[model samples]
Target: MPDECQPLHNINVGVLGHVDSGKTSLVAALSTKLSTAALDKHPQSKERGITLDLGFSSFTVPMPARLIAALPCRELQFTLVDCPGHASLIRTIIGGAQIIDMMLLVIDVTKGIQAQTAECLVVGEIATQHMVVVINKVDLLPAELRHKLVVKACKRLAQTFAATTFAGCPMVAVSAKPGGGDGPAPPAEGVPELIGELVKMVPAQPRLVRGPFLFSADHCFLVKGQGTVLTGTVLSGSAEVGGMVELPELRVVKKVKSMQVFRQPVSACRQGDRAGICVTQLDASTLERTLLCTPGSVPTFTSAIAAVEKVRFFSGTLPSKGRVHVSLGHCTLMAEVTYFGTPDGSGHEPAAALRLVLDRIGQLALNENVGEFDYSTDYAYQHELHGLEGRPSASGRQCQHYGPQWALLKFSQPVTAPKDALVIGSRFDTDVSKAACRLAFYGRLVALLRAEDPSELAHLRIFKLKMRAGSIDRVAPDGFSAVCKGMFKKDTDISLFAGMKVTTASGAVGTIEGSFGKSGKFKVAFPKGIVPAAPGHNSITLTFKRYIYDQNKRNMVQ
Candidate 1:
C-alpha cells in the first residue's frame, strides 16, 4: 500500500513516433532511468532492437524551489508509456494511446515525417487532445540544417494536424542523446524548454473519485506468492488494497491483495493513476488487455451502435463487406464491416453508413465454412451463461445491419466500455508488402443495440432521421416540386431523383420524375393524377428507397 505521507501527483505521458525515431531514447532521457530496459526486457524486442510491445517507466521531477517553498508538494511524478512504432504493432500503439493523458510525439530530424509517424499522430489526435511535438535528434545536424529541417517539419506537421483533432498544437526541438565530449555536455539543450511546454499544454488529471472504478489492463503477469497482477492506468474512480474488482468480460471477481503506484506501495489509488494491482484467486494467463470495473457499474454488451467518420487520407473507399480491426480502449477485436446504404449515384464509393459485427470474445472459429464462428465453452463463458435462462445459443449466426451516419458492432465477447467511447477501425490486412501509410477511421460508440430482435431495424430508422436531407415545396394534382435542402449534389444521378418515394404527414405519396427547374427542385409524379391532402404545415418525409436494407432478410427491399 502507498504511504499516505508521501503522496505524489501522477501524470501519464506516452512517447510515440515511427520505428527507430528514438521514442525509447527520448523516454530514457526524460526519465533518467533504465526506461529502455523496459522496452528491451522482452526477449523478442531485445533480439530485434525494436519495441514490439508497450513499455512503461516513471520519473519524478522536483518542483521549482520557489514553488515548492509555497506549495505543499515537492515534486511531480510522470509515468511514461513508450509505444511501439512498427506498422505491424499499430494495435499496441493504440492500446498505449488510450491510457495516456498527454503525448510526446517524437519526430526524427533526419527522417522528418515517416509513414508510422503520421499514423502515430493520427492515433494521438484520436486518443488525446493534449500533446507536445518533440523534434528529436537535432544534435546530428549542422546548425543551419537543423533550423531548416525544423521549419520544414513544422509545415508538414501543420498540414497533417489540419486534418486531425490536434490542429494548431505546439512543436519543440530537442536532442535526447547525450552530447559527445566535454563534462556534463550542458544538459542536452531543449530538455528544459520541452518540459516547460508540456507543463503548459497538458492539463492536470481530472478526478473521477466518485465514479465507478474503471481500469483498462494493458499488461498482466503472475508472481510466485502474490497471485495475478494487472498493470494499467486508472481511467475512472478508485481502488484500495482490500477492494474487490470485477472483470466483466471474463465474468470473474477477485479481491485486491495489494496495489502500487510507480512501484511504491499504496493503500488506495484514484483515477488517472497508473497502478500495478495484485489480485487474489485469478490466473494471469486468462487475462489479456481486459477491462476491470466496479461490479455492475459498466454496461457489458456484445454489440455497440456508433457514429463513424472516414479518414481523409485513405484513398480506397471503405469496403461494404470486409474484415477490420476495431480498437476500443485497450482491447482490439476482429470485426466485419457492413455498409448500410447504396451510393448516392455520384460514384461507386462505399456509403458512409456502416455496421461492424465483431467475433465473440474468447470464441475461436472451428471452421470458416459457417457464417459465424463457434463459441468456446471456457469457464468464464459457461459460468456467465449458467445464470441466464433460455438465452440464445452463442453458435447461432445472425445478420448484422446499420444505418446512415450510425453503425452497429456485435462482438464475440462482451465489452465493458462506457457509452461515447472512441472506437477505431483499421485495415485487417496481413500483407507485409502493403505500405504502412494505409489510413484508419475512428468513431464514437454512441449507444448499445438493445433490441430483442437480432434483425430489428428500429435503431436504423432513428439514424436515418438524423441524416434526413430535404422536404417538399409545391404539391400539384399529378406532380410535386421539392426544394432540395442542399442534400442533392449537382452531379446527382437523375435515376436517384426518379426513384425516390416522397410521403406527406397526411399519408400523401408521390414518386419523383426528374429535375423540375433550374433551381434545386425535383419534380415528383403522383399516381392517377390524384394528390392526397397535404398536412397543415406542408411537412413531408423523403424516403430514399434505394438506401433501405431489410435486416432480417439480409437484402435491399422497398
Candidate 2:
C-alpha cells in the first residue's frame, strides 16, 4: 500500500506475446488491481481459453530514488495492457500498442521465439524504445534441467534481439502459474524480480503530461444512473472535473463529472496517465471507442499524406498504388497507398493543377525536425520501396535518388485523428498460413484532407520515366543531319514528337529537328557537325517522362 496523500505517476506497460505463451497469466500474476475490462473477462475469451481483446489491469510500487529526484510522485502505477497474440487479431494488437509506454515481450521458454513472437517483436521495435523480454513457464520444465534450459533460452533471446532497439534490455524468467495453466495456482515466481527490473528502466522513459487535453477512450459503457464512463489512457494534456470534452464520433459535447485511476477518485488526469472519465447525458452505445478531447482538437479526414519508412521485417515490397490495411488512432481501416520520392536533381515542374496540391502538402510539412513531403519540390513515382541510399535507375533513362519518401493514404471511409498521429500500414490480406510479416510500412500523418475536399488532389502528378532507342540509319548528304530509324512505326504521326532531345550511344547529344520521310524516319540535327555513321550502324537513345495522373494527357521530355 502507498500513502494516500502522495501522488501516483503512471507508466502504461504492454504485455505482448504469442498465443498461449502465458501472457494473461503473467499479467494476472503481476497485477494488484483490475479495471472494468481487465483480464479475460469476455465471455468469448473464457469459452475459447484465450484473450480476444485488449485487457487492462495494473499494480503500484513505491517510487524509486531516480524518479523521486525527477518528479513529485510517491507511487508508480504500472498499467498492464494485455495484447492478444493470435495472428488474425494482429490489428487489435497494433491498435492497442499505440498507447503503451513500454512493452513486455513474453516468450514461452520451451518453444522459444515463435512466428507470432517475431511479429510482436516487430511491433515492439516500432511501438516504443523500452522493452523487457519475459521468459515465462519455466516451471513447466523438469526441475533437474530448468536452470540450464532457462539460461539457454535467455541467451538465445538476447542474441535474437541484439540488433533491435531493445538490444541489451532485461530478460527475466518467470512462472506466472507455478501449478501450470489455470485454476487456483500457487504463488508466482520471479515476478518481484521482474518488477524490480521494470522500475529500473522506467526512469529513463519519462511521460509527457503537458498540452491540450486528449484522451484515447478505448472502452465506453454506461454506469447505471450516474452517467457514461470512458476508460483509456490520456494521450496528451490534462482534464479535470467539469472540463468540457468533445466526442467527435457522436458530435456531442459533454462535461467531465468525475475521474478515477484504478477506481481511486482523482481531480484530474494528464498525459500518459490511464483513467476513467465519467460524463453525463452521452449514450454509451453511441460510441464503442473514440477520442475525448478539447472541442475540435481532432478532425475527420478522408485521406492524408505521411512521411513513411519501410519496416525491415516486412518481406514484401511497398509499391505505389498498393492497397493496405491502415491503422490510424484505434481504427484499422483499409487504405490505398500512393508512394512517391524526392531525388537529388533538377526537379520537374508540375502543371497548374498539381502545383496547387503540392502547395497544400507544403503547408502540412510541420515540426521542422522531421522531413515531410516537400510540396515546393517535385517528386517522382517510385515503382518499389527505397532505402536510405535510394534506388537504382530504370532503363538508363537518367535518375537521381534521395533517401526521404512520402505516402498518400486514401481510406475507404472517413477517419478521425489528431494531426501527426502514428500511421501503420499493413498487408492483412497476406496469407497468414505462410507466417510472413504483413506490416509494410509505418509513418506519421503530416497532411490531412478534409471530407469536403476529398477530390482536392484528383489531378495530383507523379511521373513515370520512359525511354526509346533507335539506330542512326545514315548521315544525310549534309554532315550536320542524320536519319534515325526505329524510333516510331511507319504510319506514326511524326510531327507530334518534333524537337524532342535524343542522345547517341557514342556520347553525342542531338535533337530531332523534323521528319525524314513518309516512312516515319526522323532527321537528328547536331549543330556541331557529327562524324557520319555507316548506314544503319550507330545507336541513339531518347528519354522522356509522362505524368501518371495528368488530366491534360500531357508528356514531358528533356
Candidate 3:
C-alpha cells in the first residue's frame, strides 16, 4: 500500500501501574511481541524480574470497515510506553509521563491499589488530563466475584481522585495473562471490550502548526548509517525535512536530514506525533536529552520568579529554605525554594506565594565579569580605579549585568523556559525505605524577570524613611534634598538609613531612594518624579513589605 493510502492514527499511550501489576504483561498481550523477553537487555532488571527503564512497543488495531470509510484514518497505531513501577524509578516514570498524550493506568484486580499504583496515578493526573483505568489479572477471581470487586475498585478510585482533575474516568477489566487449562479459549472476557472503550474515549491528536517547533529528546543513539538519531514526541509546532533546528542552551544549529513518524518515512511531522529525526552536523556523544527548538523562539535565562501551588496529596508544608527536585519536561534538577510574598490581611491564612531558583546543569562556560560593567556616568573612572587595563570608550559598553534582588533566583547555567510552564517540585530523597507518596508538588512558572526592568521589584520591596512629617524637601531632577526631622549623631553608618515613602494629603504616593550625607541630610530619587507637600501639614506613613506568614491565614488546603 502507498503511504497516503495507508491511513494511520498515531497516538502515544503510556502504560503505568505498580510493580508486578501486569503492566508489561498487558503490553505483551496487546502487541503480541513479547516485551518481557526484552527486559533481559538490562542485567539488573532481568535479575530482579522488573522493568527498570521505559519499554516501547507498537501495534495496529483495525477499525470496522464501515467506520473506516467515514474517517480520515483507518487504523489506531498505539505506541505504548511501559514505565518502571519501582519506588526508586519514580523519576524515570515522571520523565515518560511528560511526553505521552494519554495514559492507560493498569491495576492488579487481585491486589486493587498498591503504593506505587497511587503514586503513578498522581503523576498521570499532573501530567495529562485524559486517562483510562485497566484492571488486569481478573482470572484470579471467579466470574461472580469479579463484578463485586470491580464495583469496590471504582468507589476507591473515585475517593482517591475526588480532588484531582481525573475524578471520574472510565474503567475496564481484563486478564492479560494466559488462562490455565484452556485450549485456546475464545479470548478471555473483556479483551475486545477494553479496545472498544479506548477507541471511544481517547481524543484526537492536537494540531499545533503556528507556534515554533519544540521537541524534547528522550532517547539519543547512533544508527549504523545515520549519524545521530533522536526519538521523542513533539511538544508543540511542527518540523519538516531539511529544516533548521537549534538547541538553545548548547547554542548549536543543525539541519534535519530526514523524519519518520511511527517508522514510516514522511516529509513532515506535527504536534502530538511521536517522531524520529536524523540530524546532520551533530555528534551523537555531545547530545544528552537537550530541548530542540526553532531559532530565537525560546528565551534562555539564568534566574526566574514564579507562582507555585502545592499538590493535594503532599501532606507536609514546603520548607522555606531547602533543596527540592524540579522537573520541567525531561529536565530534572535541584532547586532552592524561598518563601516570599504576604498573605491576605485576614490574619487567618498561611503564605501562598513562593520563589524557586533552579540549579544550573549545562556545560556552558561563562565569564566572571560578564554583567558587572557599570553603566553609570562615572563608569570610566570607576573601571580605571579597579586596575582595569582596557576599557571601552563609550560608557554603556553592552556587557552583561545583574539587577536588584527581589524575588529573584539565579541559575548557574542557561535554561530555556517560557511563561506558564508547569514545574513539578518533588522532595529530593535517596533513601529507598521512604515511600514515593512524599515527593509530589506542582507549580506554575508565572513570570520571567528581566534585568533591564527596575520597576519589576517595586511590588516586592519595602521602604521606611527616616525623615519626619514636618520636613519640607527641595525636589530636583537628580534627587530631592531633605533635612532629617529626627536628630542623627555623627559617625552614624549610612547603612542604618532605611527606605522612605511619602504620601500627600491629596492621595499621591511616592518612594524615596538615596543615602544620608555628612550633613545629616538625605537625597531621595523617585522613578515617577516627586509629589509636592506642605511642610508640617502632610501625612507620612512608614512602608514595609508584608510577610505572608505574618498574616496567619490558612490559604492552602490539602
> lDDT scores for all predictions?
0.63, 0.78, 0.59
Task: Write one digit per residue (lDDT tens) for candidate 2, span 246-351.
Answer: 9876668898999888898988888888899999988888787789988888888888888776766677887777788999768889888888765432333333
Candidate 2 weakest lDDT stretch, 10 residues:
355-364
Indicate the residue-level lDDT of 406 in model 3.
Answer: 19
Number of the top candidate by TM-score? 2
lDDT of 2: 0.78
lDDT top scorer: 2
Scored against the true structure, residue 266 in model 1 reaches a CA lDDT of 83
lDDT of 2 at 6: 29
Q: Which of candidates 1 and 2 reaches a greater TM-score?
A: 2
Candidate 2 regions with alpha-carbon error over 4 angstroms? 1-6, 204-206, 344-371, 386-402, 450-455, 458-461, 476-478, 489-500, 514-519, 534-537
lDDT tens digits by residue: candidate 1, 239-350: 8888988887777888889987766788888877878888877888877788888887767766765545454444445654456778888778866554332223121323
In the range 161-248, model 3's lDDT, one tens digit per residue, is 5544565678888888756331553354576777777677556433446789988776677777776878777877888888998877
Which sections of candidate 3 miss by over 4 Å? Answer: 1-6, 32-44, 62-71, 142-144, 179-189, 204-206, 340-413, 416-420, 430-432, 449-543, 546-558
